[model samples]
Target chain A: GAGVSQTPSNKVTEKGKYVELRCDPISGHTALYWYRQSLGQGPEFLIYFQGTGAADDSGLPNDRFFAVRPEGSVSTLKIQRTERGDSAVYLCASSLGGGRRPYEQYFGPGTRLTVT
Target chain B: GQQVMQIPQYQHVQEGEDFTTYCNSSTTLSNIQWYKQRPGGHPVFLIQLVKSGEVKKQKRLTFQFGEAKKNSSLHITATQTTDVGTYFCAGEGGGTSYGKLTFGQGTILTVHP
Candidate 1:
């Protein structure tokens, strides 16, 4: 792909429902990240993956938000029991590597999730 | 979580006027980056600042990083309608996650031509 790609650009769901968002990073980029941005705010870090392992997930608000990059390529963010506060734009970005190397991040179009 | 603060949350300018936005971080940053997001569009990286008191220019856009490494600024000379967009500053501090960035609440620029 020319750039990072996100699935289901927009999703609408009711409170208490479950929702899943997907991200396909650049073909060979080794680092992936997930961020959430509410209206009138900048993107907030959620999690980052280096290959198959989650290098840092401290940014995730709670256990209700979980993300997985099993094969080290495509990643999925699953929200259990969605709430109205979860409404925001979910952005995905990828970088070259995780350690020592300084890499520039390429972002995706982002998935807008709206919980009613 | 680290927080980045940007002043003048909104700026409106007439065509050919100049505009600027300032960003300040609560902590020292290993590196800082600037991004622009047009209305209804995704953010696009404009440039990165690393060294203290660093300055870079991209056409009519100029960016500066404070010697303290805790602040940054982006200036657009002779603003045009094409320059209308929200500018964001993100900080990457040492010891934080390798690829994590704490973004400032962006500054929205509106140019009337």
Candidate 2:
């Protein structure tokens, strides 16, 4: 669409439940990123995508967290066996693919996930 | 592990007062970008500094990149109630891995009316 968009705005799930958060990036943006923000902290990088491929997933905290952008436009972040520690805001951003200027990142209204 | 640290975690300023925040990187940065996130809102991009000792301004907001490329600052000349938000400085380390930014702990600014 016009800007990065995320779905469900908020999600509250119980421990051991699986949850999914979705993000739809700006049209024609080939670079996408996901981040997590805990209380009183800045967003932390979780993964980055170049097209449909994850160029970097080093920031994923554990195997329980995973994300995919199969079509390079819409992406999903999945959490398995959600824990209270996983409660945070999930953010999505997009930018024009690799070039001399990787300066700006358009972000979405993040999804607040609360694991009880 | 290449982190960014910000000082003065919280600041309260009266409307029309000036506010400033500092960011320091564990390593030299290839570039620095600033963003603002209002309470309960997502972050919005502000500006980026690429050249050493570079300074830029947007209205009352001034941004500076240090000559060492290891630190940066954001100064709001005349803060307004609308300027109340958390300001963050993200650093891109010098290398191919520099494309992805590592953000500093943000400074939450509260502007009193």
Report how far off residue B83 is in candidate 1 (Å): 0.8
Tens-digit per-residue lDDT, B1-113, candidate 2? 78999988999999989999999999998889999999889999999999999999999999999999999999998899999889999987755554577998899999999
- Model 2 residue A86 CA deviation (Å) reads 0.5
State, as a TM-score between 0 and 1, how close model 2 is to the true structure. Answer: 0.96
Clashing pairs for predicted structure model 2, backbone only: none
Which lDDT tens digits does candidate 2 get at residues A1-116?
Answer: 37899998999999999999999999999999999999899889888888999877878999999999998899999999999999999999998874346658889999999999
Off by over 4 Å in 1: none
Write down the C-alpha DockQ for each prediction.
0.72, 0.65
Per TM-score, the best of the predicted structures is 1
CAPRI verdict (incorrect, acceptable, medium, high) for model 2: medium
Q: What is the lDDT of residue B112 in candidate 2?
A: 95
Q: Per-residue lDDT of B15-106 in model 1, one digit per residue for the tens?
A: 99999999999988888999898988888888989899999999999999999999999999999999999999998877854577889999
What DockQ score does model 2 reach against the true complex?
0.65
Give the lDDT of residue A91 in candidate 2: 96
